[model samples]
Target: MAAATAETPTDRMPILAAVCLAAVVLPLGFAGGAVATPAIGADLGGSPTAMGWITNAFMLTFGSSLMAAGALADQFGRKRLFMTGIAAFAALSLALSLAPTILVVDILRAGQGFAAAAALAGGTSALAQEFEGYARTRAFSLLGATFGVGLAFGPLLAGFLIASLGWRAIFLSGTIIGAIALLLAGKRMRESRDPHAVGLDWPGALAFTAMLTLFTYGVIEAPEVGWSHPIVAASLLGAAATLAVFIAVETRSARPMLDLTLFRYPLFIGVQVLPVATCYCYVVLLVLLPLRFIGVGGLSEIDAGLLLVALSAPMLVVPLIASQLVRWFSAGALSGAGLLLAAVGLFWLAHVDPAASGMAVILPMLLIGAGTGVPWGLMDGLSISVVPKERAGMATGIFSTTRVAGEGVALAIVNAILASLAEARLSTFVPQGGAEIRAAAQRLAMGDVHGAAAILPALPAAEIHNSYAVAFQHLSIVLVGITVVSALIVFALLRGDRASSPRAKSPDDTGFDSIKTGSAMS
Candidate 1:
């Protein structure tokens, strides 16, 4: 790793703003794309299979590549890497806006996601290094709040912009904001790196990436192509083999990219996998709800965006609230409670027909939003808080990877579930169409009603609508089941664990050691 170097005086304001903006943009990229999916897909003539890829490809590459990028930030310099990531993210996003076809956009989105990994890893490391004591906790809370705001506001803003300016405007907006963040971050943040860092583990990185990619691909394609398809079987089998190799390599490596030893800590294991439950529900809904609103309710884009506030607004407010509540309740309490609330929301939502009124969607979303707010903020803070300052890079790596991977997998699983159900219900409606009706069901799951209808002349609109309504409830029940079971599991594992407990504090707390009294942070 490079030695720390002298730099210009650090300005916390600009650094904070830049990191917040970067975090905001990351989710904005996802949610905005979700808001704009129909327009983008329609223009690109994208099939349902390809439509999912527009978002999934980015998430797959981003989630898998994060650890490698985080390690590189530790080896090189975080301040520099952070700025470079911002710049690359801007360029790639701009390239995405100009892409003529959906395929090109998907390919570039993955590249942008890869670049975003650096921003995420570097930004969190910089924060942990610069802030300390109670102040560091405050910073983490604010950081989480800003992240929620970005996610919450994404649909609202993207809705307006896409309505007036078109879908490409969303990426163009990212390009502009990223440029501004690049300059601010470059001028304000100080340089730092891990002094004990060794060479990169290229083999481990490849194995890790391949494992996640193949597994995600298999799950996403299963409903469309069938689980027994040779390609799907190969992908899942390959993922398993690669996972074993990754674990073996990490256990043996002197300087592993991902320290599997961290799993020994039960709390770490619980907190790390928390995303699998929360995001598995949250992100899939983020995709499906918009589709339901626009496709079934026939709401305008702006109306749909406004409706989403019921979900994301509570998420935005909860972190700031959680930061203060830690004085009364433990992070684990808030997290577990949040999951239970989410389960309740899911159960409520499961009963709502797809053709239900807007209020039907809004009420459960508020409950889910409030529940979501509690955990994400604390879970994120704990991820870094649990580890020593030196291992912040690794912590963020695993943390970000888990969250994004869960999101991608959840989206895929939901898509598969809905598609499978759609096909089953639709088969009765279009019995004569055979395989054509089956393919149409996949399109239905991807939120492509027109595309699905275009494939079969006899595809009854009533049948299509009923199929989706049923599919949504089935997926919601699946989510409810998972969230409740997960909440119970976490309660069992993390019960009595308190954030205020000294046990929760890292023995190698960087807040006391990493930051010096005043001047600048280098």
Candidate 2:
């Protein structure tokens, strides 16, 4: 409290700027790395599997290390971890830009993920420390908006850089941003740590990271090798066992980093579900729709990027608007209504032809982005609101882990579903129950029409595209159903109720109780 009170608005501005800069770099890596992958493969000459790792390596490590980073921030120091992370991120980005081989790129990408986790977990927690009450809400809202800016422009920027400056420019860009954030935070941000924090929860940390790694690996591999494949089966089983071990360790630990009891609070549970719901309703489409437009619809990369802009554009303003709307509406009602609107957009997107004029898709994309933006803006602030401020690092960590890990899982599941559905549709057209059709379907589902053609030289490209289109339509319907169900559940869980528990801490320093649906956010 002394640290917070000591900082005037002028002092806090640099802290906010630093965290926002770090936030922007993260999504840039996410979206930009995906865009740069093809170019990296072309220049470095790697197998499809190795090429996939360029992105997968970053995601797996980033998602797995978040919880550990969060706990460490609380124990060690948020400002200390934040500065270290940004410095490491800058160093790694420089190394990635100079990487001579695809293997080097993959390894560096993994390192980048670890750095990202530290920067995000520490930076966000530091933000919670610097700003309180309504100001905290506004700061987090700006953070969300900054993330949207990265996601919204990542593709277009990456595409331009790849075409004009080479793929290395993408990593170089990250380096520049990271260096700036590092300098700003190093000079101004004050260090803070939980006085009650104990020694690291080593067993729980190991188990949780292992669980995420195994599950993500299994999901990524499942689409390529059949689910029945021994490797995929082993990985998934191992993940489940590790998860059980993690739960046991946390429940028994004297100072568990995760605090599993938080799950007992309905408000806490509701806050967590928001990200997973958005992953399915909005995040997956960021990957899938581009594949549909370029591979199945025969659009150029430029055209595909434009459509993606349409899809993500609403994120720019919609989230800020949703923040203001909290003044009059229950966040629960707003969140539920937003998801329903996104579901409607998904339904419309399902029926629209991917190759059709851009206008046909623009309206639906806007609807989906605008709808999903509401929860995105609120979820960050709500994450801390439900817990004591001293535990802000842990709360931010849990929310972020759920968001990033949930995205990886969701993308893997949807990709698997699309591949399976395509396989079924391809069988009807090819009339052969063989490995060739299965292989071709997997490629088609991933938006690699040329690759599918290579495998099935006899099959017509039109038939392949047609099969993929039908599969995508089916997948969209499935997403629609899930979003609707998630909306109802979220509304029910979040509708104007305070979390109650004998062990729960008293109201935070701001004296605000758990955020309710219809109350002022402060």
Q: Which candidate is the best by TM-score?
A: 2
Looking at model 2, residue 250 earns an lDDT score of 96
lDDT of 1 by residue, 228-319 (tens): 99999999999999999998998999989988776766677777757787886577788888877777777777788888878898877887
Compared with the true structure, the alpha-carbon lDDT of candidate 2 equals 0.81
Cα lDDT of model 1 overall? Answer: 0.78
User: TM-score per candidate, in order?
Assistant: 0.93, 0.94
- Please give the clash total of every predicted structure, in order: 0, 1
**Over 4 Å off in model 2, which ranges?**
45-48, 431-433, 499-522
What is the C-alpha lDDT profile of model 2 across 349-369, one tens digit per residue?
888875665678888888899
RMSD of 1: 4.1
Among the numbered candidates, top lDDT falls to: 2
lDDT of each: 0.78, 0.81
